[model samples]
Target: MLFLKPPGVYAPQDDTSLLTTALHEEPLAPGARVLDLCTGTGALALAAARRGARVTAVDTSRLAVLTCRLNARLAGARVRALRGDLLGAVPDERFDLVLSNPPYVPSPHPQLPRRGRARAWEAGRDGRALLDRICSEVADRLRPGGVVLIVQSAFSGVAPTLDALVRTGLDAQVADRRYVPFGPRLRERAAWLRTQGLVAAGVEKEELVVIRGEAAL
Candidate 1:
């Protein structure tokens, strides 16, 4: 499930840097309520925090949370990092902006990516299980007009993810997108990649979907 020797820290990968940059580009308020899901090493959370947002970052790994706090302090970001899986740690919190780069690998077998956090890189066979859960639950924790920004693989079939959002009944659209390279492959994973037209797409510069529909009524 772990790929790097320094498993607890995020030393900057291509995708990671991309996500961080996107956060820097968001037009959030100086004191925006921000929620960062599966916050790895708190990179995005830290970025948002530095922008003056009251950021709350969540991660299931104890090491990850600690590392996030460390990263935040190193970056001088005022972020609240926690050790909890998904939304477990913050059952009663709502935010103006929610961000996550969840696990979307579609494999029945339980295996971790050899590059990033293992828990942050694996999903069900369709790779939509966690993404589905997050999409559906996000509305419950977002204020009206709030935004949910996420990064998932094109290989997971972007359409299905959008369907999940529609099924959740939230208005959403792809705001920013870019091609990202597939790091490695698991059994049949490449086939799934091809099915999504990602194998030839060469990882596909994923995206940051912005979701904020007319009040989740």
Candidate 2:
């Protein structure tokens, strides 16, 4: 599928691919409702739509929303693209599956960016800004037996995510993990990560993990 990403919109990358793989593993019945938070290029949403699921993709960036819509159109996939903060725009809706690849890179900045390309990857100091939000609120938007697939770097606290979901009465675990060399963002933050003890000395690779959380039946 052809995706047109304007400047400032995040292009699909390893995290996106990993999330898509996990999405495919789910049992998506025909017409199952799927929600892609921080949808970016809408790759996962389009993939779900192609599987005969009804998909809705949400992003905080307008450019991202437009890019997702264009990509969905190009792929001949039906997806509702909305521009808003994660899970905030669809408060009344519940879905069978929820997918997210929200910003998980630790940023030098203490707060998330209000705009610009940094918003695509910068997630405050610990990179848990958005991840925590998802863990806290996603269960509420999931129907009984619904599942959520989320991808994040190991630098972020994977166990915390699991604990958060468990506390919310969902079964959560790491469904997939891949070791990838540092991307440009991580490479640039190597020094800070070392200072923060997020990375070991001279470590150049990080693990990307796809976490699956299922709402109680």
Candidate 3:
């Protein structure tokens, strides 16, 4: 799907390819229990709910949570939107499938568009803050044979992400990818793109890497 939107947009246009692929790959499957992490605009949860899944979406921003709740109500989907960072806000619970499109931009700039701790596009100090944490905790929060799907950017390269998830004992796979144009920080990622054979071809350093893996049983 195309996820086009205005620049510096607070929320993403689409729910990311991982969500769409997950829906196509596994789908709601009757009464599936789903968890959507960092649900910026509730797209995944709402979509899954439409497919007959009971979804609970969590975000760190109150505005995001409210937006999602309102959208869910409007769409007549049984989706719960809660405000919380990562998995803290929700009570103890497990789901058949867990999904997230966490903040993946790695930046050295102090002043970013969304500067809030959890709302920022990139995790602070090497950009591995939230991704690492999520990988480490997913195994425990997931049920037996549960699936964990995350959409991370290849900004800093996919190797780091693959290594980290593998280190967490999850068998990772790149389910899908998309080439996006550089919006704000095009120059910053030029060198990295060159290594990936993207820059010399006039392609910008914007891309999405969707990963799928099951929690250790």
Q: Name the candidate that leads on TM-score.
A: 2
What tens digits encode model 2's per-residue C-alpha lDDT throughout 1-217? 4568777888888898888889888998999999999988888899899999999999999989999999999998899999988999898899999999999998888977898989899998999999999999999999999999999998988999999999998999999999999999999889999999999998999899999999988
- TM-score for candidate 2, residues paired by index: 0.98
List residue ranges in candidate 3 displaced over 4 A. 1-9, 14-18, 110-118, 185-205
Looking at model 2, the pairs that clash are none
Whole-model lDDT values for every prediction: 0.69, 0.92, 0.71
lDDT tens digits, residues 110-196, model 1?
Answer: 454444455666776677767877877887888877777777766566776666666766787665566554455343366665675
lDDT of 3 by residue, 1-217 (tens): 3322222324653326455666668745788888999887677777788888889998877667777787787777899888887877666888888888777666554343344543547665355667877887776677777888888767655777677677777787887887766755446656654665545766664677777877667
Q: Best candidate, lDDT-wise?
A: 2
Q: List the residue pairs that clash in candidate 1.
A: 178-205, 179-204, 179-205, 180-204, 180-205
**Clashes in model 3: which pairs?**
none
Point out the higher-scoring one by TM-score: 1 or 2.
2
Better of 2 and 3 by TM-score: 2
The clash numbers for all candidates, in the given order, read: 5, 0, 0
TM-score of 1: 0.80
